[model samples]
Target: MSLYGGMNTAQGSNSCLCDLRSDTMTAPDGAMRAAMAAAVVGDDVYGEDPTVTVLESRLATLLDKEAAVFMPTGTQSNLASLMAHCGRGDEIIVGDPYHIYCDEAAGASVLGGISMNAIATQANGAVSPADVTAAIKVDDPHYARSRLLCLENTVGGQVIPLDDMRAAARVAWDAGLFVHLDGARFFNAITALGCEAIELANYADSISICMSKGLGAPVGSVLVGSSALIMQARRNRKILGGSMRQAGVLAAAALHALDHNLPDLERDHANACALATALTEMGAGDIQLGSNMLFFTPRDKNPDALRIHMADAGIRIGGQSPAIRMVLHRDVTDDGLDATITAFQSYFTKE
Candidate 1:
């Protein structure tokens, strides 16, 4: 019963599984709901939504950007950013495993007529400056003009070292390319790196911050960058149908999360470390800890069987091939972590 004993949602029954799928599963708490209900509303399309303005401005200042725009999701936010940064027929240099290239449905190319020239990523998720330099296309008519370089922080839950990120950005800037960062887990990276928000932000021309991820906001992602770029993204947002009215309800939740959940992101990281330590000690296969996320392969090398066993034990995990990631977030408390370890114990130690 302790597996999901601390969950705060009514959507799940009295007896529920401890969900370790992703931080996206976190629900807005009572205080966040109250803030949403009490939020002031306006027409955001017309730029009159006060709460949304506050959220955008707060992030802009926090990241030392000239402006920020809120989007319904990080995917759209990144797409808008790519569109804003790259022109039609222009190319972007990004890591092959980055969310922009791998997960966002290649919207930059599909919708924006932009091309992604992917460079291989290291185990720690940092792209080499040499690869970036080599990936940039020549100024000839045959090649797509490389106009932007995209990077992600806390890729697979591991923080990209600050110096490495800066070096990559320097290569892009020297080549006259704009730098865009998929900062979906922005706060988690900062907590793990122990640096100020601007320190990680200074190198990128634009950063997409997703509040709904580990920050525990019900929904909202912010794109912070230069005012001119943001102005263009607003139009892109409208074209992409990301423009919202009376969206202060969602913005209010993000504002609340910034105050309460953002500071406590470290708790999730600690829990992840604990899980990794326990699983490693128990001879769990290749447990990799990344910030607040951990990746594990079943000892039996049967992910399907592991999924079944964990589910039977009141713990829910993803069924990703090779290895599955178990995320730690605000909703997953110490008790949930203990339950997860206990479930692993039963399976790995059995027979």
Candidate 2:
């Protein structure tokens, strides 16, 4: 099967097409591969992987954190952070649709025995301070102790405003809860808000950043936090079997992505906006544009039918109708974008 579940040519097809399924579909380019090939290797389990150390330190400095630790995936990174912050039977407040609650396989609860208090998120993807206030449990013995507040930026392709995030974090802090940010799309949020990484980091006690998404690394995520928190997360990482040996090759790709691919996110954002505008003009779908993602809902055609048509025309999309997410990445070209636009126009015109 294709890396993105059951989609694309991996389902026994021969078409090498434009894939809009997710930014996770991105592959490392030539320069990234070169960096990985030339990386000086060492055992990360012993804290001797220089490349990994550099990547962690760079991100820590950028986010203005005291320390950082690399993990195999964002799922593990976020889980380790949770395990470090809260003990068994403790509770964390999170948005109902956020990845930590809906996705991640409920790792926090399953592995750490941490309870999740899911609150309704606003349309803009921000959990209100009032919701945070309402969710915090008292010192009563009957309720799970609320120990953490988790927030995600660029949730479902919407950037939660910094002011909103600060307000939410303030609420969490006042309630004696630590804040964790699932910033898998951290750079996308940074580009959208035109803010420095440290500015965003100021609102959260810890952040989990995925390099394999828009950053275009082959694999790896990093958790950045205070030195004590990161040290605890490192121990949790080892316990979760996330500690690595000879991990510099993977870290090198992430380093290359930070140096090279991050600046191109603005282009991806522009492409997403352009595609959203085209779909809007064609009356093809209900479009919601967010940074580097576009949600398109077909107005006059079945979503499955549209999917097959696009696939036949050498384009791939994900999810079922009424809304399909199309993500722009460093790998998707302007020609691919034009071809995708043409494919949609042809399908709807024929209808």
Candidate 3:
């Protein structure tokens, strides 16, 4: 009765549908659906959704934060946290390749009227602490106030170690700037680091944890921080059109995910490592496995061909151009991985 097995059988293709596109593709399992159906409901806009309240409380406790607010997506959670912590004309230091900088539609600037100062990230997805120190703005009427330092772990599937995060946080704190973490995959990093989520959360004034990523919830992310910050974030969420009424149904699934799915992430990580090893052996570009994300660049610059070939084989992957990235999730299995390996080998062998 696991929801993990299904294949696209309409075509003549024998390939099992192994969705490695993103963690967003995962469907709610039976337990998740059941939890949703049976969930106690209340108006979350009025701060009364019992399920959501439980989820927030649980996440806050897990992260050792004073409070938590549930939001529609990781982007919203991160933006709301940033909006809460920073003011207009404020600048936030972030890595050049971070989701906020490269993705996210520049909400920090457009909506919050904040400026982003990009710092170079090392190959390990960590910025130099010295760079953070140097980026802090001098108090001047002409210069934008550097109010916050934002960090992303598992950046583009590259995990930054705890020491790097601590050093950066220390630099930001010494500069009197608030620190925020776009921890969409904080759980994955925690599992990978063999540390409690708080170990990372402690360094940042706010941390955004995604329920829908490795946790396999159908939707939502949690932003955890001090109670005052969460109260402010709730207002920002409302402003951003994220306030939901009677959202406990979704919160129930998230609760189910936290309880049942977190431990299974190790399997996903293992599968990623296995896939990386296989792809590297098959002469694919360096396969870097970080938690559940496997970023593999091809030896040649033919990402389009690889994408098309995989699509034909019914194995969905993401990314194009210079490099192709693959993510392993609970929906993918050891058997499905074999099929993916076969598909890749078949595609490359003929080329």
Candidate 4:
């Protein structure tokens, strides 16, 4: 059972439902709310918010970085990191399907005049070192200088192996490029790998960690790097209007999540695997299981009809076929998993 219980139930007419759309749907539990309410808050813009300061310091230590800056969203955190690393007409090497290239609204190019050299990513979510090496540009006026390489852990929920990360980072560093990790699902990857977070962080020059996703906090992401890099990122954050006042309320919730919810991410992963197994057994869809996420492609039923059937059963999903992603979080209970499996079973049976 979840400490937060069923969040979909609270949304009205969806009582005791399962929301598989995304882990971002999680709401803070009562314990997290209590922490928020009791948080010691000061103006964060002035860098006096004690809770925010603690959260940043703790994350910095956990990731073995010299400093960390808190931002309102993961998008802004990545943008700040990008802007801090690259200058006008500079480029970053990134995976084509990764969040920094596809989901972040092109803030680097739109706001900082940075270009992205998107390389093809492997099915395992790693960009090949050969591709990365080939992407680095020479110092020519006609070409954009490749200043940095951006990588994502758990890209599309698949954890990138530590060996692969090191290889890619080595390729970047040997070419005189800095490395940044979009680690929005850093803990999820850590949980699945059964490794310390610092192990992953050691491979990158900086990392952006989201507290709101599988960690179950309502908001906030942290950017961790060397003090000099963080100082630059802080300025970039301010330019992007990510500076917050009295942000400790949100930080406290993140603190609570780090303390209470992180350990349970493995449970969400187990539930995802269980759901995938059940879906596979029913011949409902082709299933791809990753840490706390499952992608299903219906075999016998129409995708739209399957979606409508699940929606009617109070089970919500996201994306369009050939694959629909279902995310598990702290808010999704074992019963919710059962309901989801049954919904799929029923949908396929009636076809």
Each candidate: what lDDT? 0.89, 0.91, 0.86, 0.89
lDDT of 1 by residue, 180-298 (tens): 99999999999999999999999899999999998889899999999999999999998897599999999999999988887789888988899899999998798888998888887
What clash pairs does model 4 have?
A: none
Better of 1 and 2 by TM-score: 2
Residue 205 shift from truth in candidate 2, angstroms: 0.4
* Cα lDDT of model 2 by residue, 10-59, tens digit: 54322446778889888888899999999998999989999999999999
Candidate order by lDDT, highest to lowest?
2, 4, 1, 3
Query: Model 2 segments beyond 4 Å from truth?
Result: 1-5, 8-15
> Which candidate leads in lDDT?
2
Weakest 10 consecutive residues, lDDT, candidate 2?
Answer: 5-14
TM-score quality measure for candidate 3: 0.94
| True-structure Cα RMSD, model 3 | 4.2
Candidate maximizing TM-score: 2
Cα TM-score per model? 0.95, 0.97, 0.94, 0.95
List candidate 3 stretches off by more than 4 Å: 1-16
Looking at model 3, residue 166 earns an lDDT score of 95
lDDT of 4 by residue, 152-260 (tens): 9998789889999999999999999999999999999999988999999999999999999988899999999999999999999989985999999999999999888
Return whichever of 1 and 3 wins on TM-score: 1
Name the regions of candidate 1 deviating beyond 4 angstroms.
1-15
Residue 51 lDDT (model 3): 94
TM-score of 1: 0.95
